[model samples]
Target chain A: MIEVKKLRKSFDGRTVLHDIDATFYTGKTNLIIGQSGSGKTVLVKSLVGLLRPDKGEILFDGRNLLTMTSQEVKELRKEIGMLFQGSALFDSETVLGNVMFPLTMFTSMSRAEMLDRAMFCIERVNLKGAENKYPSEISGGMQKRVAIARAIALNPKYLFCDEPNSGLDPKTSIVIDELLSDITHEYGITTVINTHDMNSVLGIGENIIFINKGHREWVGDMSQIYTTSNEALNDFVFATRLFQDVRAYVAKHGKI
Target chain B: MILTNSLANFGRYCMFLTRTFSIPDRWSVFGKRTIQEVSKLGIDSIPLVIIISLFIGAVCTIQMQLNVSSPLIPSYSVGLATREIILLEFSNSILCLILAGKVGSNIASEIGTMRVTEQIDALEIMGVNSANYLTLPKIVAFVFFMPVLSVLCMGTAFIGGWCVAAFTDIIPVSRYVYGLQTMFTEWYVWYGLIKSLVFAFLIASISSYCGYYVKGGALQVGKASTDAVVSSSIFILLFDVILTKLLLQ
Candidate 1:
């Protein structure tokens, strides 16, 4: 589990996230949802240590991640995994090579063992036939799966994915979402996914935090989301006509 | 204010460099990376360097022959002049300048692309010291391979000059060979090699630094690549002056 207390981050005197606090539980998909430039990216980046919060306490299993020494930080990071928005597979390496990278870096596994483990991960992601292909040769959805395979290669206790479903079709997005949800439950990992996709929020978002202008506005699960009366959250969530119609129907019916 | 910013950037770069050369997590991994970098930065660069060096040597001989037109001067001086220029400047500084374009920009673009794409972040989150894993291998590779490249460059240039001298009849082959033998001090070889080593480090270090800290998207990556090549060339020239003063004096 990860606990963030009073987190704040700013760039060039313009504050991005302030007074943000949330708890991401193990074995659940926690989603941070907001519009573009709404500070969700900054917040997630801070959580992952890519950006340093101006003031905050990020407790990973009750240890302050903000104050750890360099060596300790690296050791702490071994239990952490991140899937970038673009999937971020090394362009030079094949799918198998990309998934095998973390193991090659952090493990004492022999070459044969490493290959076996990498093969297992590729198969687990349902990418068995695409092992030898480069990331460029695969679809965006497949790249995300490769990224997921690489992320879980170490069996990390914590997983962070940034915009996991962006640029993917609806069908592929659902597949990726289900994969992430399944993996979170299967591995019992504290998984935090940052996204603005309302579909993702309604689908796999077991716990959700809505940020508007660096402030946390509403916090709850998908089930509560459809029924929430928070005006700003409603504005952002139901901005589209289709979602607004769903909201009206749900309101009339009293459930989604 | 600009001075202050520049100084701050320099400090940050120095700190990054310190982190880049730290002890590896696994020597086997590092060794493998080092060998790959060596092949890319050194072995792969051989043909281009050879072609450039040969052409440069040929031109140097012809230019010396044209300018030293006085019958009073020995034909051997043409060979001597070509030898001196090739060894001192052409082989080390010129070749490095050329490679600043070839290899430096490559390092910058690659690292910059990775940064923009979040590959570096992926490495950091994995607990891999990204700097050490990525840049150190290239640095070590350049330091070790550059002297070998300098030797090859110098050898090719000298032979090219010899070929020009023999074919063009600017100087007889026997006389040109005699001129090469006349005052062939060993220290010049060492001097060219020392310069190559320093230039190699600067190229790899500056280029990698630019790439690693790149911001924004593809445009920024391209900007970083340009900055790397430009910075590397400027530093190579500046160091040439400083090293020339300190070493030769």
Candidate 2:
């Protein structure tokens, strides 16, 4: 499990994350939802050690991430995997090369073994036939899958994905969500996803935290989001007429 | 205000070069990447370097002839001047300035794009020292290639002078040959090469520093590319005088 304690971050005297605390358990998909510029990216970045918090401790298991020595931090990083928003695969490397990179960098595995491991991850992400293709040669959805394959190449204990569905079609988005959900369970990895896509929230958000104006507005799962009386949650999540109608119908019938 | 900003940039540049030497996780990774960068920044650069060196050599010879029309000094003196200027200054310093615009901007934009695109962050999150991984190989390749390119420039400059003099009725062939061999100190070649080595280090490191820390989007990346070339050119000129004073004086 990953635990954040009173995390606060500011940029040029403007607070972007305000005294936020949350815990993400292992073997579950935890989603952070907020409107653009709502500090969701900042919050996730802080959690991933890309941005240092102004005040707070991020405990991966029990060790404070902010206080760990550089060597210790590097060791801890080996247990973490991140899928970037743009599917940040190296432009120079093929899909198989991309997936094989972390293993080549961090391990003494033989060349044949690395290739096998990489091929396995690529197949797991359903990108088996695209092994030799460059990231640009494939579609955006394929690129995201390649990114996922690369992220899980090292068999990390924690996984983080930033906007995994952006620019993808609805069908591909669902495929990515289901893939993430399957991996979280299969690997028992603590997974954190930052997204504003309502479909993702309803589909794969086992634990959801909503942020508004740099503060946590509500925390719940898909089953609990419909019944939350929080003003911000209602305003944002049910802002659509269709969703509001569904909520009203559910409240009246208690069946959704 | 400008002074403060310049000082701050200088401090950051110094720190960046200093920090790149702290050992990497794997030396083979660095070595293989250095070979790759040599192909990118050095091998591919040869044609342009050759073209520029030849033309500059021709121009230097012509200009020297124009400046010294007096019959007393003899045409051989012009050849000597052309050889010295091409090797000691133009090939090393001016060629570096050109590369500062070409290679320097490329280093900045490529890395800046990687930065904005989150590729560098991806490396860092993998526990890789992105700085050493990205820039050190580039620096190593430039340092190794610059002196060789400078020598090539000098040789081509001499050939250009010979060809131009042969085609034109300007100077006798004997005097030009005499000029090439007369009072030629092998140490001058070493001096010019040393100058190029220093300038290469400046270009690679300064341009990389500009690129690696770039923020924002495409516009900011373009800005970083411009800043890299501009800063690298300025530093190359400054180091020219400083190294000349330190080494040649």
Candidate 3:
């Protein structure tokens, strides 16, 4: 489990996140959701040590991530895997090679073992036959799969995905989301996903934290989200046409 | 405004330097980047350098034949002049220009694309020292490969001049070899090699830095590429002047 307390951040004197606190439970998809520039990305990045918080303690299973030494941080990183929004696969490497990168850097495994592990991860992501293909030769969805394959290749204890559905079609987005959820349940990894996709929030957000203008607006599950009468949450949920229709339907039936 | 910003920039750079240097494994990362940079900058640049060196030698010889009417200044001096100029300026300075146009642009574009796409961020998240992994190898490769390319450029230019002199009847074959042997200096060759090494470092580092710091998207990458090449070229020329004045004296 990951716990953050009073997390705060600023860029050039402009505060982006303020006194935010949340917990991400293991074996479930913990989502940080907000609109653009709402500090969701910054908060998640801080949690992952990508960005340093001006104030707060991020305890990963009780180890304070903020105060860890560089060596300790590297060790901590080995327990974590990240899937970037843009599917940050190394353009120069083939699918298999990209998947094998983290292993090569951090492991004593032989080349054959590395290849075998990479193949297993690739197949796990349903990218079985595309091992030799470079990232440029593949579609965006395929690239995201490759990124996922690489992220999981290390068998990390913590999985962090930043907008995994960005640039993907609705169908592909659902596939990606389901895959992440399934992986989280299967591996029992503490998974934190930063997303704005309402579909993702409703479909797989078992533990959700909503950020608005850099502050934690609400924290709840999908079941509690629609019932919450918070104005900001209502505004965000109803802003979408599909959710608006759903809200109206519930209202007409007096079920909301 | 300028002064405050400049000071702020300096502080930022110092912070970056401290952060990068604090890591013990950065040397290994540097070694990796050096190899990549060498392959991109040195190996890929062979064709252009060869083609340009040959033409430059030929042109110098032709110009010598046209301008010199004094029999006292031997026709073989054409080859000698080509050798001297190629070693002193053409190979070191001209090749820097070529690299600023070619390799510099490549470094900037690649790094800029990586930055925009968040590949660099991915590296950081993985606890990779992005600067050392990305920049060090290129610097090392430039330091090693630039000198080798300088020698190749000098040799090719001399051959090109020899070819022109022989074909145009400006200098006989035997006299061209004699002039080359007489004019050759270990110090001059070393001086040129040293210059090439400096040029390589400046070009690769500045270009890579530009790309690494790029923001936004495709347009930003393009702008970084342009800026890298322009800055590298200007710095190369400026360094060349300073090194020439110091080393030659």
DockQ (CA atoms), all models: 0.84, 0.83, 0.64
- For candidate 3, the C-alpha RMSD (Å) to the true structure equals 2.5
Off by over 4 Å in 2: A245-256
**Model 2, residue B116: displacement in angstroms?**
0.6
lDDT of 3 by residue, B1-249 (tens): 999976885576556444444443545435665676677778989999899998998887778667765878886676677678888999999888887889899989999999998999988888777876776677668778988888889888888888876786766788777767775788999899999989988887778778888989999999999999998898899999899999999
**Against the true structure, whose DockQ is highest?**
1
Tens-digit lDDT track for model 3 on A19-116?
A: 99999999999999988999988998899898999999999999999999988998999889999998999998999989998887778888899999
Error of 1 at B12 (Å): 1.5
lDDT of 1 by residue, B76-159 (tens): 887788888888888899999999999999999999999998999888889888899899999999889998888899889988
lDDT by residue (B1-249, candidate 2, tens digit) is 999998998898778777676787788888999999898998888888888888887788888889998978887988889888986788899989998988999899999999999999999899988888899999999899988788888888888888888888878767877888888888888888898999999899988999998999999999999999998998899999998898788
Write the number of the candidate with greater lDDT, choosing between 1 and 3: 1
Lowest lDDT block of 10, candidate 3 chain B:
B20-29
Off by over 4 Å in 3: A253-256, B1-37
Task: List the candidates ranked by lDDT, beginning with the highest.
Answer: 1, 2, 3
What's the distance in Å from true for residue B207, model 2?
A: 0.4
- lDDT values of the candidates? 0.92, 0.91, 0.87
Pick out the ten consecutive residues of candidate 2 chain A with the lowest summed lDDT: A231-240
